[model samples]
Target: MRESQPRESGAQAILEKYDRESQFRLNLGKWGLIVTFLGVYLTVFHLYTGYFGVLPSQKQGAIHLGTALGLIFLLFPAKKGMQKHQKTVPWYDIILAFLAMYISYHKVIFLDSILQSRITGYHPFDMILSIVGILLVLEATRRTVGLPIVIVAGITILYTIFGKYIPTQLLSHPGFSIDRIATNLWYQESGVFGTPIQISSKFIFLFLFFGVMLVHTRIGAFFNDLAFSLTGRYTGGTAKAAVSASALQGMVSGSSVGNTVASGSFTIPMMKKAGFKPEFAAATEASASTGGQIMPPLMGAAAFIMMEYLGVDFSTIMLAALVPAMLYFTGIFIGTHFEAKKRGIVGLPKEALPNFKKLMLRNGYMLLPLIVIVGTIMIGFTPQRAAIIGIVSAYLISLIRKESRLSLKQTIYVLEEGARVALPVIAAVATAGIIAGVVSITGLGAKFATGIIALSGGILPFALMLTMVACIILGMGLPTTANYVVTATVAAPALINTFGLEPIAVHMFVFYFGIVADITPPVCLAAYAGAGIAKANPFRTGLNAVKLAIAAFIIPYIFIYDPILLLVDVTIPHFVLAVVTAFLGMLAVSSAMIGFFVSNSRIWERVLLMLGGLLMIHPEVYSNVAGFLLMAIVWLLQRNRKNGEVSQSAAV
Candidate 1:
C-alpha cells in the first residue's frame, strides 16, 4: 500500500509545533510563566479541597471556571491580520488572566455566605455571572482541545434536556429542566466538577508534575542509557531498547503519542541502522510505546480513575497490572527478536552500547525518585504526598551532578511545560465528568450495563468480547484516560454485576482494551505517529503493531477467565500454576505470531501453537496438560527436522 504523504506531513507538523513551542521561544515566557503559576495554584487548591473536603459546591464551580479560562488564555492561537498566528499573550490575555484570579478569589471569599440561605432568591447578577462563566468554559474547551469534544459535550447537554423524547430501549429518561440541568452540570459535583475532574486535580496533576521533575533531573536520559546498556547488544537490540525505554517512560509520561514521538526518534533510527525496515521499526516503537499505558507504577491517569471508581488502593491496582504489563512488553520484545533473526540482522557494535557500570556511577541517583514514590505509596502514604516527595527528590538528586542540576529558570520551564501538557488532560477529564454525571443522575450506567448483559445472553466470554469491541471503538476516538473512564463507568460494572468477576479484574479488563485502541485500526494514532517518523504506510504499520501485540489482546481475557492470574480468589498453589501456565501460553502466542520457533514454522505448527496457547490460558487442568503435550510434539518435530538436515548433508 502507498503511504499517504499528506496525512503524514500534517501530523508531523502538529507534533513539531507543539514540541518547538514547548520551549517557550519568541519571548513568550512571561505569559507562559503567568499561566503556569495559575495552573499550579488551581492544582494546589483542588488537592487541598480533595483532601479536606472543605470547599462548597459554588466555590468549586468557580475554581473550575477559572482554571478552564486560564488554560484557554495559555493555549489559544491569536489572530494576526489574515493569518492565525501562535504567539505570546496579548492585552486581552491579561484581562482574562485578572478575571480568572478575581473569579477564584470571589469564590473562595464570598460564595460561602451566599450559600448560607437555601431559599435565597435568584439574583440577576448571579444568573448573569453564571451564564458568563459557562460560556467561558465552553470557549476554553474549544480552544484547548479541538471542536469534536466540545461538540460531544454539547450533545450531552442537549441529551439531558431532550432525552425524554428519544424512543429507544437504551435511551430512557424523564428529562430535566434547563435550570436543573445547569444546576447539576454547573453548580453541583455530578457534572463538570465530577470525579473525573477531582481525580485530575488531586492525582493526575501531581503525577504529571512529578514526571516534569523527573524529566528535568535527566531521568528520561537515564532510562534511555539503562535500556541501551541492557539490550543494545542483542539481536534487533535497538528496537528492544526502544521497547524497554518506552515501557519505563510510559510509567511516567501518561501519553502514548508523546512517548512514541519522544522515544521513537532515537530508537527508530537505530533500528533502521540495524537493518530493520523503517515501517517495521516505526511499528515496533509504536506498539511498545502504546503498551506503556498498561505498564504499572503509573498506568496513565486511568489507574487513578479506576481506584476512585472502584474504591481500591493504588497498590492493589498496581499489583494486579504487573503480569499483564509484563506479558504485553514480552510479546513486543519477542516479535522484534524474531523479525531481526528472520532478516539476519546483527546487533549494535559493543562500543555503541552504554557502559552500564560507568553510566550508573554517574547517574544512579536519578532512579531514587521512582523508588521513593513506590516505597512511600507502599508504606501507606497518600499518592499525593508520595508525589510531592517524589518531586522534591527529583530536584535534590539532580543536584548530585552539575550538568543535571536544574537552575531556577529551568525549574520554571519544567513547571510551565508540565502545565501545558496537563491542560488537555484536565479538559478531557472535566468534560468526561459531565458524561459520567449524566449517566449517574439518569441511572444510565445501570441501564447501559443491563442492556449489554442482555445482549451477551449472560455469557462471560461473549460479554467480554462485546466489551472489548466497545472499548476499542471508544478508544479510537478518545484519549486512553477518557476511554477508560467511560468504559469503566458503563461496561465494567456489567462484567462485575452480571458475570460476578472481581471488581479489580473487571476494571483492568476494560483498561487494557481501552489502551490497545492506540494500536488498533481506523484511529490508531500511535501507529500513525510512528509512520510519520518512518515514512511508512500508516495502515500497514498499524497492522504490524496489532500483530505484534496479539498477546495484549488475548492476555486480558485470560486473566478475566482465570482470576487466579490476577491474584484473586487463589491459593498459593493455584497462583503458581496460573502464572506458569500463563507464561507458557504467552510464549506460544508470541511464537505463533512471529512464525518462528527453533526454525520456520509451518501453517499446521502455527495453528497448533495458537490452540496450545488458548488452552493453557484456560483454567482447566486437562486443557493445561493438553497444551503441554501439543508444545512437546512441536518441539520434537523441529528437532527431527534439524537432525534430518544433518543426515542429508552427511549422505551427500
Candidate 2:
C-alpha cells in the first residue's frame, strides 16, 4: 500500500496535465494560509447547514456559488502557463474574485426585497449585476472547468438574445428583452441557482466531503489491499485487481481520470511487471475506473442529480443502477481473464498477495462509513444527513487504529481538500444551470425532443443511438456533473418523451454514456491519464478501453429496450433470469472482443459469440434459448478442438 514520494509526484503531475480539476494553486507561503482558511470555512459552512438547517434555496445557492467562485479564482490560474507552480494569486485575479463574490451576495442581500416586490422587470442595478454575474460565472468556469460548458452557455445566451431572427420555426422563439433575460438568468432559481446548483450546494458537497474523509482515513488503500487479496492469485490477477480496486475507489472517487491516476499509479506498474501489454494494462484500469461513476452509493454524485431530474427517491435510482454497474465490471473482468489466458500470463505470486481473511478482520470497520451513508438513506434520512453522518463515521472509524487516525491538522486539511475539490463542480453546475435555464425559458427542451424524434423517424432504437452519441460527445468536454445536467436536460427528453420510457431508465441511459465518454476515443481523458502512467499509446489505450468497457455501451441500449436490466417493476424470477443471462451475454461479448475464449476463439466463433451474446442479453425466452445454444455450440467446439490438438501432439 506504500508508494514512493516520486511515484506520488508523478501521479500528481499526470493528474494536473489531463484533469483540470486537479490543476490548482499550491497556495505558497502567506497565500497557503489564506487558501487553507478559505477551504476550511467552505467545508464548515456546508457541514453547519447540513446539521442545523439550510437557508432558502436562493440564499443557500448564492453563498455556495459566492464562496466557490472566490476559491476557484484564487486557486486556479486564468491560464495554465500564467501561474506556474501556483506561486501566488495575481492582483487582477484577486479583484475578479471579489467581484464574483459581490455578484453572488447581490442575490442574497436583495432576494427578500425582490420577492416582496414581485416585480417582473429588472432594476438598473440588478440588470448590470446580472450581466456581470453571468460573465463572472463563465470566467470562473473557464478557469476551473474548461471552455466547452462556457461555450455552451454562451450559445444559449446568444440564442436567447437572437432567437426571434432565426428562420427555422423549430429552432427559433421570440427572443426575450434584455431585462427579462437578465432577471431570469440571475434572479430566478431557473438559471445560476437552479436545480443543478441546488443539488450541488445541498447534497453533492456533503457527499464530496464524505469522499475526502474516506481518503483521509486511508479507506482507498484498504480497498486496494482488499482487491489485491481477492484477485492477485487468479489469472491476470493484477489487472483484475485494478478493476476491483478502481471500482471500489470510483464509488466515492467520482473523477474517472482522477481515479485512474490514483489507482493506476499503483496497479499499472504491477500489470506491466506481470507481463500484460502496457496498453492493455492502462486500458483495463481506465475502463474499470470509468465504471465507478456508474456504481451506487455515490455514483460520482450523479445519483442525486438523477433523483431530482427523475423526480424519484434516492433509493429507487440507486437500486436501478446496481445490475448495470455489475454487468459493466463483469465485462472488464472477463476481458482481462481472456487477455491473460491469450498471453499465457500467470497470476501474481500467492505469497506476494495479502491474506484476505486477516486483512478483512483487521480493517473491516473501514466499511462502516459507506454502510452508514447507504443505510441512513435507505432508512429515510435525507442525502445531506446521510453524508454528514458518513463523514463523521469515517472520522470515528479512523480513530480505531492509530495508523488510520487523523490529527487535528490533518482533519482541517481534509476539510480544505473537500472544499477545494468541490470548486470545479460548483462552477460546472452553475454554468450548466444557465443552459438549463435557457432551455426552460425558450421551451427548447420540447422542441429539441421533437426534433430528435423527427430525425430518428420515431424509432426508439435510432433515437437511443442519437442520444448516446450526443451524451458521449458532450461528456468528452464537460465534467461529469455538467455533462449529466446538459444531456439530461436536452438529450434525455428525446428518449423519455418519444418512447414513454421509464424516467429512471431514460436518465440512467444518458448517465451511463456520459461517464464512459472519459474512455471514448480522440479525447478520452481517463485513457490518456492511464496511458501516461503505463507509458503506453493513448489512442490505443482508448480503443482497448472501449473494447473492455463494451458492456457500458451495450447495457444502456439493453436497459432502454428491456428495462428489466435496470430492475424496474420486475418479479424476482424475472430479475434473476435477466441478470444471469445478461452476465452470460457479457461473457460471450467480452470473449469475442478479446478474440479469446476457452483456448482461443476462431474468427467465425468470435462472430457467433457476439451475435449470441446480444441475443441472450435481449431478455426474451426464445432469444435466450437460441443464444445459450450458440454459446454451448462454441464452447463444445473449442473444447473438442483443444483436446484434438493435445492428442495430435501426444502422437507426434
Candidate 3:
C-alpha cells in the first residue's frame, strides 16, 4: 500500500486552510483532555435527550448553545494561523469561555423566573446577562463560523436598534430599544434561541452525531469503494466514481469543503494519475461534493429546518428534493463523462477494479443506518427518533466487522468527535437565529420579499434571477444552515408571495442556490479545497466547477417554472415525461457546455444544443419538440461527419 502519510498531511493542511472548523488548537495535554471531556459530555447530553425527552425549547437551545460556546472558545482561537503554535488557552479566552457558559445557561437556571417576568420584563441583571450573552454568541460565532455571518448578524442588530432613522420609507422599521432588542434576541425564543437553534439542537446535531459515528466505522471508505466498484471500469470512471462517492459522503460529511477534501484527497490524485488535467480533476470533485448538500436525507442538515419552515414532514422534503438532486448530479456526471471522452481518458484497468458483488457482500450493511433513518421517518417517527435509531444502528452495524468495531475508548472518542465536528454548525445556527430573530421582529422578511418583487418589476423570472443572486451572495459566507435560514426568511418569500409558487418550490429554489455558492466563483471554498488537493489554480478550478455544475444553475429555474420537476402535485405520466425531458435537456446542455456530443461539436452545433436544452428543460410540449429537433439536427451533422471520417480512414 502507498504510504498514507503524505496524503494525510496534505489533506489536513488543506482542510485547516479552507475549513475554519478544522482549524483548532490541539495537543495541549490537560486542556485537550478538558476539551475532550466537554465534547463527549455534549454529545452524550444530546443523545440522552434524543432518547428520552427533550427539554423545553429555551432550556434545550440554551444548554446546546452554551456548551457549544464553551467548546468554541477553547478549541478555536480568536485569530487564524494560531492553531499550529498555540500551546494553551489564553486567560482572556478562558474567561470568555466560562462567561459564555454562564450567560447562555442563565436562562436554563432561571427559566421559571424568566417566564414569570415576561410581562413584568427583565430585571437589570437579567438584561445585563442578555446583553453579554448576545455579545458572547457573536464572538463565538466569529471564531467558529468566520466573520461574514457575524458581520451580517451585527448589521442586522444595528438595523434592529436604529432602523427608525433609515432614510428610505420602504426599508425602514420603527426600530427597537436596547432592552427590547436584547430581550427579544437573548431571553426570548425568537432570537439566539429561536427556530434555527432549536432545530440545530434537536434534529441537526443528532444527524451530525450520526455522521460522525459513520466516520468512525470507516463508512466513507465503504462509500468510495462502493462507488468505484460500480463506476471504476467505465470511461472517465475515476471521475464518475468521485462524483458518486462524494455525493454519498457529502450528505453525511455535512460541509462541501470538508467533503471535497476528504474525498478529493483520494479521488483527485487518482484522476490526475489517470490522465485528467489537475484543474478538471479538482473541478469534478468540487462540483460533485458541492451537490451533496442538495442530496436527499441530510441535505447538509438543512432538510429539518426546511421541514419547520415549510410546515411539512421530513418525507415531503426528501421527496421534493429527490428529482432536482438527481438532476444536479446528472449534470456533473455527464460533464465528467464528456470530459473523459474528450481527453481519451480510459477507466482503470478491469483487473484493478473492485468486485461490486463482493464489496457489497462484505460491507453493504453499512448502508443500513441511512436506510433505517429514512424508513423510520417515513413510517412516522420524529426526525429525532429516527436519528437515534440511526445512530444506534450505525454503532451496532460497525461491530459486525472486528476491524470496524469500536473499543470503549474509541466509542468515547466518537462521541467527542461528534460534538467537536458540530461546533461550527451550532455556532452558525445560533448566529442565524439572531438574523432570523431580527427579520421576524422587524417584518424584514416581508419587506425584503416585497423589495425583490418590486425590483424585478413583478417579473417572475427576473425575481427568481434576483433571488438566486441573493442566495449565492448570502451562501458565500454562511454555513449551510445559516444560508438556508436567511434565504428562506428573506428570499423565499419573494418568489412565493409574488408568483404564488408552491412553498416547497420556492424554498428549494433558495436552497439550491445557497448550496451552489460553495462551488460558485470568487469565494467558492469547496472548489478551492479541491484545487488545493489537486494542486491546481483555485480560481480556474472554481470556474470549471461552475461549468460542470451548470445544471444546478438551470435546474432551479426549470423547477420554479414547472413545479412538476420538484414532484409537487405530479401525476405518473407527467413526472415520467418531466424526468425524461429534463434528462435530455441536461444531456444537450452538458454536451454544449463541454463542446462535445456524439463527436467534437462545432460552435454552431453547441449553440443550437444549448438553445435546445433550455427549451426542452422549460417543460412545455412545443419547446420540448423544438429542442429535440434542434438537438437532432446537431446529432445528425456530427454523426455524418464522424461516419465520413471513419469511411475515409477505413479506405486509407
For model 3 the TM-score comes to 0.98
Between candidates 1 and 2, the TM-score winner: 2
Error of 2 at 93 (Å): 0.5
**Candidate 2: which stretches are off by over 4 Å?**
1-7, 117-120
> What digit string (tens of lDDT, one per residue) describes model 1 on residues 1-652?
1011133444445354323222222334356556657656655564465456535444564565466567555545432121123355577766765665465455557665545522564455554544454555555555554455567667877887888898985776888876566545654567766788777766777788788788877788889999999998888888889999999998888677878888887788788888988888988988988888888787788899888888878887778888778878888888888788777887788897899999988778778998998898888988878777887788888888899888877765666566666776776776677677777777878888888888889888788899999999877766777778778878888789887888888888889888988889877878888888877888988898998888779888888777776667879998888878877877777778778766678999988988988788777899999998887788789879978998999999
- Screening candidate 2 with a backbone cut-off below 3 angstroms (N, C-alpha, C), the clashing residue pairs are none
Judged by lDDT against the true structure, how good is candidate 2?
0.88
lDDT of 2 by residue, 1-652 (tens): 0011133578988988898887676544456677777788889999999999899999999999998998888878888755455556778888888899888987889887767544655567877888888889999999887888898889889999999999999999989987788778888888989999999989999999899999988999999999999999999999999999999999988889999999999999999999999999999999999898888888877678889987877877788888899999999999999999999998989899999999989988889999999999999998888888998899899898888888888787788889988998899999989999999999999989988998899988888888889899888888888889988988887777778898888888888888889999998999999999999999999999999999999998888877987777899998899899999999999999999988899899999999999999897999999999999999999999999999999999
Q: After superposition, how far is residue 526 of candidate 3 from its true place, in Å?
A: 0.4
Stretch of 10 with least lDDT, candidate 1 = 18-27
lDDT of 3 by residue, 1-652 (tens): 0011133679989998889887777634457777778888899999999999899999999899999999899888889978667768787888998899988888899899999889887899988898899899888888888999999999999999899999998889888999888888887888889899999889999999999888888999999999998999999999999999999998887689999988998999999999999999999999999888888887777778999998888888888888998998999999999989889999988789888999988888899999999899899999889999999999999889899999988887788889988899889888899999999999998889778878999988889888889889998899878999999888887777777888998888888898889999899999999999998999999999998999999998888888998777889999898999999999999999999998988898899999999999998999999999999999999889999999999999
Quantify how close model 2 is to the true structure by its C-alpha RMSD in Å: 2.3
| Residue 298 of model 3, lDDT score | 77
lDDT of 1: 0.75
Candidate 1 displacement at residue 489 in angstroms: 1.7
TM-score of each: 0.90, 0.97, 0.98
